[model samples]
Target: MRRGYWLILVATILLVTGYHLRFQAPATITAEQGTANLGNWDFTHQGPVSLSGDWLFFPGQLHTPASFLQTLQTTGGAGRAPQTLPVPATWNKLYRHQSSHPLAQGRGYGTYALKLTGTGHSSLGLVQQPACTSSRSYFFPASAPSSQPVSTLGHVAATAPQSLPHQQPVFSALRTRPGAPHYLLVQVANFDHRLGGLCRAVYLGTQQQLFDLQLQRLIGQGLTIAIIFSMTIYAFAIYFYTPHNRSSLWLGLWALCATLYFWTRANFWEQAFGTGGTFGFAFHYTVEYCSLLLMGPFIIYFHHHAYRTRYVAERLLRGNFAAVLLLCLAVLVTPVEWFTRYYTPLMWLMLAQLLLAGYILLRALHDRQKNAVRLGISALPLFFTIPVDLFANLNGKPSGSYTELAMVFFVFMQGLVQGRRLGLVIVRSQHLSDSLAEEVKHQTASLEEKNYELLIARTALEEANRDLKALSITDGLTGAYNRLYFDRQFLIEWQRARRERCPLSLVLVDIDHFKALNDNHGHLAGDQGLKAIVSHLHAIFRRASDVVCRYGGEEFVVLLPNTSPDQAAAAAEELRALVASTPLHYHDQEIYYTVSIGVGGLPAPGPSQQPLDLLSAADRALYQVKRDGRNGVGVADVIAADIRA
Candidate 1:
């Protein structure tokens, strides 16, 4: 069964991966020797083409379109010749004259120029998405009369301060004349991040095709984020409503952090809120670092709760959380350049976290812990993807949708595990309820026989009779006093209250929408909900003289000695609020419920009045509360036969 389940999960992952790959635009032609000849290419048929391969690279120079054109014309291939470097690669990887050392460091600025030849006169669109710290591109069309670029993205400067970094994607339309070469110049500056120059692919297509592609990418990212956020909400709901499950809380926090991290990476904010300035840039990196750092600790915390290696896991969790806090603090206080230099260290830290997680999982498996295999199955995707993502980040490459898809699969598996656990709990509860009912019946008969033979019974028999009597009067499921006990106790309390000239109160509580809960969530859930409400009743009315009883299904009665009608009403309101606020969690599902409380008391009972009158009065008030909408407290003074809310 387990092997079959795993096979199904793997198949689902492959299906999702295939769906993600379907949207990717494939490149057919590669630019060589600083120029791409597209004479044989058809833009309408090919969709979009990637401008990847050798491009003219001018190290340490930030050149404009007009200046570069003038320089090339004036120099006429003189001493200041440009080198051919691969597009979609950082300048830090560029070597000088067969030397091992790089030609330029990551901190410097540079210009990249690409020439397009043999393209027929057709209106075209260019898309550039640079993953470096910052960049600006100028598109000079062949049909233009002047040296000025027809379209420009931001303003690239020689110095860091003068540069306005364009982190968002840029799209430009070109009107190309027949039999002319077009010049595309991109100037990049990187004073902050670890990689400079064109790190992402540039594409060319028709204007509408590029726009449609961009829209599709945005929609895909938006849908993925939406699914992650929904899972976050579900995890949080379980954490808050369930009795004890800190794992869900950490899981929710981790999902939230992952969502925010991906959102910024996708540059969705730029589309929604427009171009990000200096503040936006800083905010982006800050959120990125904080979210990434926090995710590790959050996952560790989640694993700590899911599996028990607490002593070691607890120490690890504390250290990781503290380190994350310090790193986040550094990101907030220091300049982007100063903090970004520690990217290698951050990567190492993340790697360590991954190793620690592996250790924990191994330890759990060695110990033969419950649900260990299931957890391993769920975590398989993350274990595979995190390393791949880390490698991509290290190499300045764009990460794929593997991590997102993995998270989706992980959440699905978690839901399945939780559902199975809930099923087990329900089955166990039903079995226990059945066994307890049979035990109670047998004990009741024994108690009756022992009472008749008390003279013949020994001391042990007397004690057993007492234990059986106690069990007979108490509810099997909720452990509250039963209705029979309440009936006899209520009369005794009423007579004593009348003799002592003191008030005696009765608070009747009923669970609202109980039948609906049972119908929707099943009888097992209803049984658990009943027990939860009874627990609240016992907690609130805990005086030694007070008696809590399960009057019937989804209805409970509290006998408060020396409590007035007003006092009982206040207590009932407190109980009502408590029950309404605390939801019953069955696995991933949170079931919220409320109670209608009816308070009835005799402040000074007349000689003619009976105990049944008080019960009748409380029932009437309960009816009134139900009629006036449930989840509220209503009061009735039996002496005056008046009811109030």
Candidate 2:
């Protein structure tokens, strides 16, 4: 088929899809007035109710929910997906006129308002009421979070009021009998971006329900991840599989490093699958950039097209790599909200990346070379579509399927080009029989030598990897187990202690006014000071079981698997005095840095015990010591007693 025909075919499909989405009917439900009244309703078990009919009216500003979705899906998409919204976040955000979470592509943005009115319980609280846990059909008995029971509406159940703010402000002073229609008024509208949005409301007078929602903001995140993965694969292919060898081997190796860093070292897997939180959120957000950084060398290698290309591309590549690394470090070493403002800096970085890709593609197009043009064309859709896709999702007009279709086209085109080129080369190879045989022999011998060397390297790598993994747990400066290692060891030790019913002590060591020392001298001198103190801590960490690491830039954590608070304090005090006595000379000032230590011991460690809580208790004690005076140790329980007194 002609390529033009393919384009026309795809265009027809899109038009048909859009036409289908543009018009759709609203599902109707019978109602008495513009209201509904019922008691003890459960949406979770019953799912979305179709309350669409004559009395079931929406304000003129907004269309019915079912009809609205129908129009959107038919015009812009198919029932394949309805753009997801972030659920369980602050409702206060929903009211903003232009407020939008990340949606499909960068091109989309706006806000929509939704309101529901019924003459019934407006008392559903903001706190997540548990969905029905019982397997009963349609309904269950009413109950409260407390041990007490509550009223029931038909088979539907309502829970007693707890210390939760009412989620809905609408008032309802009415009731309904079986088959009798009631009134319901729902008003919804969007202020910007074509007034495009979703306004869904449910009145499940009765039925079983399950909750399903798209975390809209999460779509931007998922798209970013998918792009990183796709781009990485492309880079890997360019470096390892492409006929161009100007710098292929090195580029491939760097791509491998980036892949490892993204998957393992950077904690992308942890955030997506493991524990989700500030750490998860932060990692999840930045891992894409880290992956990009890792993929940079190959981008540069391929961007230059050959070693013969200008020095500036190579220089720019290094500069970009360094900037990314600095950004990563800055994020880690600095306080939150400084560099992570979500919009400004992040948007700028995304813009920079777009420009870079644009320049490469434009340059490739101008070259008039087949391979260069092919490479550029292969990556064109991704470069244009991914960011646009993110912007749209954030704006509530997502097109994930369109993006996937573009990607499929790219892969197919690239594969065809590569296969054609390889086939031609194979047909031309018969003329150089002697040369080909010699080349094969040389390659075979080289492969054998490489295999032997690889075997030796593999053994050495395994042993080194094992040791490095152990050392990774240890804080480099402190020569003790670091936070990452401490976390792993803490779980193991805590479980053992729980099983054995034993005590565990944790101490937090904060250097009093260490920041002042750095201010006085310099960061380099301060680093040396920390190294000296870590050396001391290392000497004291005698038992194989005890673990310690730099908990904060200026703080250290010590874990005693089985020790009392008193014992922990004694250890802390000894380290403090040793640091005080061991003064170091930095710059003109012969600086002395003292340590303020807080010690805490668990009466018993168990699954329920949080290691951070123990650290927090120690931190509170350390605060008390700092208040009393610097250069001292305080135990959490002891300090608590003194504070009480």
Candidate 3:
């Protein structure tokens, strides 16, 4: 594993080295020599010289370079002398002789004059400083000895060269013959009120060399963009797989902010999308402010995960996020001028944040947390680069995106730490899984034993349920089905008869003088008689489809499926005779009873035919037997007519 990590580190180093070499700038001289004898300087190998040093500075406005030179000669004996401010510096810092908090002093215009004698090149490249809202340069020679036309001297406007008249010469390009002294006047306006005017070195190089420098800057920015973009993608993927790791998510957002910061500063937005004016201005500052503000929380959260802290890191992380969010809102709504003024302080605040993060990392290192030392080692570049850039800008020196490279390197190292952590988690999980498998096997055997016992209990419960259901339908006294069972069976038989297209018969039998027998022979004798009749009923309803049930007190009902009315009436007569002849021997006494039987039948039940209706007809027939004479079989009128047929 250690070897793998080393291999990865070596590969990354090689890749970055290759990218740097691929887009490397052409070899050129620093040209930091003093402002004298520029004509003797070589234009090819020692390309552009840093035009840094003392220059004649005129605040407010001086149109023509001749006017600026006149102001310089007199030295203003009675009035204020021309303030000798340094070139390649913001007027905000240099104008009042106060060097700090230049933006708070605010907006103005200035003209800087420098004398030079150089041989004519293809062109003189004029690079505008970032803070200069608008600028124009006027070129002059020792004598009017040039092929290019020189316009009549007039008030030199501070507008761009594109807006100037064609006759007048501008500093977009300065053509000259050898051995001629050239005086250059550059006019700059500070509309933004902060970091105003050229703070970077001016270069005088061949057109081809200047173009190569521009290309090199672009290629380097592109490479940084690709590097940061990949880091963002990797962070997001890690967050997606492990949502609990908030550090990964914050790192992704931080990487995204870094990309946007470079994009805005590198002027890629204008080149790709043509986004200019107020929207572009707003977008650039918003991105810049957010990128700076977000760095604090990202570092804190990363430390919270990568190392151990005393819960203070969590609070810091939350506070940092809230502060960044508020700053984002301020950057969006506040005017660019106001924001630019505060940008320096905000940068200082960021430097302080960097220190705080470093303090937390140092604590982690003290505690010897996993990967703490490696992570600190990786972030060393960022710690140095960020302050370097901040101080460079404060001192009015150009510090290209060295901080961006530092951030990429830091994120790459964090990613490696995360990968190592994930690897450890996977190994531990595999070990736990093996233990869990054994536990599951034991639980499975125990569960099977319990399940077998449950199956036996379930079977016994089903049988008990069936016996209880039978008891619910059975009559308690006579061991016959009660009226409730009769009603249910009547419907079943009626439907079955209809389906089979056969007649269904119902015979209602009532014991004659049953109430009198109950009064004289006592209820016990009556119950014995009922049991005797039930035994005869069971014999009569021998067929599986036939049902016998006690309709009510002293009332018995028999259901004969697929039986005609004639057959039903005949069966009822036999039941009546059986009751009259069979004697119930109770307490050494023989008791005889007769029954009045009624028969009702439906020839293939229909929709109009009902089970209750059929039972009612049978009841009416029994009433007729009671009305005429007791102990006789009676058939319904419809069944009697069918039997006659």
Candidate 4:
């Protein structure tokens, strides 16, 4: 019975060893595997291991897993000595020292072979594709048939990944028997003309860990999409409210471009368009190229509006648009080879745009435009990311969507800046409105005061005008009615007397030898004498029916409305006697003066008699008085029927 138990135990040990050999892989399959130590790694404690060691590189060759296995069976993959290249390093740079190599800096198919040792549940992943076109990765048991595939990872998509929002890397799951060897083969035959090489480290881990990692990536991508979509809608809404605000429009466009780019690079379009058609591939790359081109205008105009560079901003924005559009059109119409050949140079254009944007932002900050300071500060992340992305692209590495992440922050900060600026503008507008209202109030009060002053001036002017009219009809020297007043009165009195059949008489008085008095006593004494004579005339012609005026120099005329020639002659004699008796005080001397007087009358009404007829008759009588003797009165014996003065 003990012998039987020993046999059973040996059988059990043999079965257990056989099962372990059939399912689990060895810890070290070769010298290269020992260096990687995949079996020794603790899957639960550690992250994915880097397959960043030396790889046997074959250039200008297209080999599938079957073909590679067949070749390996024939010669153990040693027919031609393979070139050595480091994973996670650019193949272009690796061959840069070997200028004679046909694949050096020249785009073509390349196969990379490496050995990995891990348990049956291991998974393999090429975390990044330098250029995502016509690339494939495979993992299989080294001893397995060439026709069978352990696992296969196809190219993520034929989409360009220069811009943000690209698909996640493809990870392959593989199983190997215990103590058995396995191999990893990565084949890249990109038609895209770009620097060819591994940009990121390859990762090897358990299937569960890879699943968890992919789920995490999926979550990250989803969040990126949601953030970009929400921002796009928000910016578009802002643009709708302020249709003239170019910044909001550009921001919306920027977000939209980012979303489209992400869709293609992330292989979301693959599910819709599938990865087979040329159109899908072209469309994917075209979206990427267009998005890259759009970056310039969006960034430029955003700051243009934020900085208030309205004068030159629109022109620059249109120019940027035209340039980007033309370039995108070229990218679309150009052949694949042409695009690939110029892809790096095209990427360099982004550098130019970045530099230009930096200059514009810096200039805006320097000019002290409102919000420019904040916008510039917000762009610091983008500025840092630009050079990093540029270097990464040139070296064929994965930069992810760092620029897009920076843009998200930039957009948020810009929104805050715009909101703040709007609030300030509203405050300023209210203040200005209040100030204008106060100014209007002051102006209205001033205008009312001016109107009151004008009314007062108008009243004073009317009173002065009346006084001026009186002065115009009065003599300046004698304070008596002028000749013009006498002429007017003479006509009225003459006509009235004719209608009444009453007598109208005219009495004329002259200062005797007034010229001699003026020449001897001076004009001052003469003026005083004239004034004294006028005063006596006023006393003599006290009746309301009489009119008195200074007819000429040193002469006076008095019209008596209802008096005869006899009565007028008596009045003239009285005026002559009064003037001869009166004395005029001139300066310090009292000067005595004498006068001659004449009287005439219109005895009855006659149509042929005029006002001048009485004056001429009176003048003739006055000459008689002056000829006869000084200081006397004379009456006309007859009035002239027709006389002209």
Full candidate order by lDDT, most accurate first: 1, 3, 4, 2
lDDT (CA) for every model shown?
0.77, 0.48, 0.68, 0.66
Index of the highest-TM-score prediction: 1
* Per-residue C-alpha lDDT of model 1 across residues 1-645, encoded as one tens digit per residue: 356656876776676666577658656468887789988888888788888899987777777776777766665567565677898887666542334433355776778888888767488888888446667666765445344554444456667787655567878887777678887887777766667778888888889888988887887777778767876887887765554778878888988998888888888767778757666777777888889888888887877788655626456578779989998998999877678778878978988887777777778888888788988888888998988998888777788888889887887687666656555655765565555445554334425655634533332333333545767898877778999999999888878887787888899999998999999999999999987887788779879999999999888999988998988988888899899889899978988989998888888666777888888889999989999999899887546622232
Write candidate 4's Cα lDDT for 334-435 as tens digits: 755467567677777777877777887788777787666777867899889877886886766656566656655665565566555455655765565554
Q: Residue-pair clashes per candidate, as listed?
A: 0, 38, 0, 8
Question: Model 1: clashing residue pairs?
Answer: none
Model 4: pairs clashing at backbone N, Cα or C within 3 Å: 24-177, 24-178, 165-262, 166-265, 166-266, 167-265, 167-266, 193-340
List, residue by residue over 1-645, the lDDT tens digit for candidate 3: 377776876787566656666544333222222234566677777765556677666667745655655665566555665655566676656654554533336455667666675555546654333434445566667464232323221223443232111111122345665677776566666554356654545555666666666667677778778788887898888787677777778778778877887776676776677655445645666676777677676776666665545536457667777887788788788876688778678888888778877887888888887677878987899899989998876655656556766776776777787777666766765555544444333323324767755644443334333545655787777777888898888888787876777888899989889999999899999988887888888777788878889989999999998898889998888888887888889899988878898999877777556677788889999999999988999998663222321
Residue 126's C-alpha lDDT in candidate 3? 44
Q: Of 2 and 3, which scores higher on TM-score?
A: 3
The residue ranges of model 4 lying beyond 4 angstroms of the native Cα positions read 1-35, 63-81, 97-100, 118-132, 150-171, 197-201, 271-276, 310-317, 421-645
* Top candidate (lDDT): 1
- After superposition, which runs of candidate 1 have C-alpha atoms over 4 Å from their true positions? 1-15, 75-81, 95-103, 141-153, 308-313, 422-645
Once superposed on the true structure, which residue ranges of model 3 sit more than 4 Å away at CA? Answer: 1-36, 65-83, 95-106, 120-124, 140-174, 308-310, 313-316, 400-402, 422-645
Task: Rank all candidate structures by their TM-score, best first, as comma-separated numbers.
Answer: 1, 3, 4, 2
Residue-level error in angstroms, candidate 4, position 185: 2.2
The residue ranges of model 2 lying beyond 4 angstroms of the native Cα positions read 1-272, 292-301, 306-312, 332-339, 393-408, 415-434, 438-645
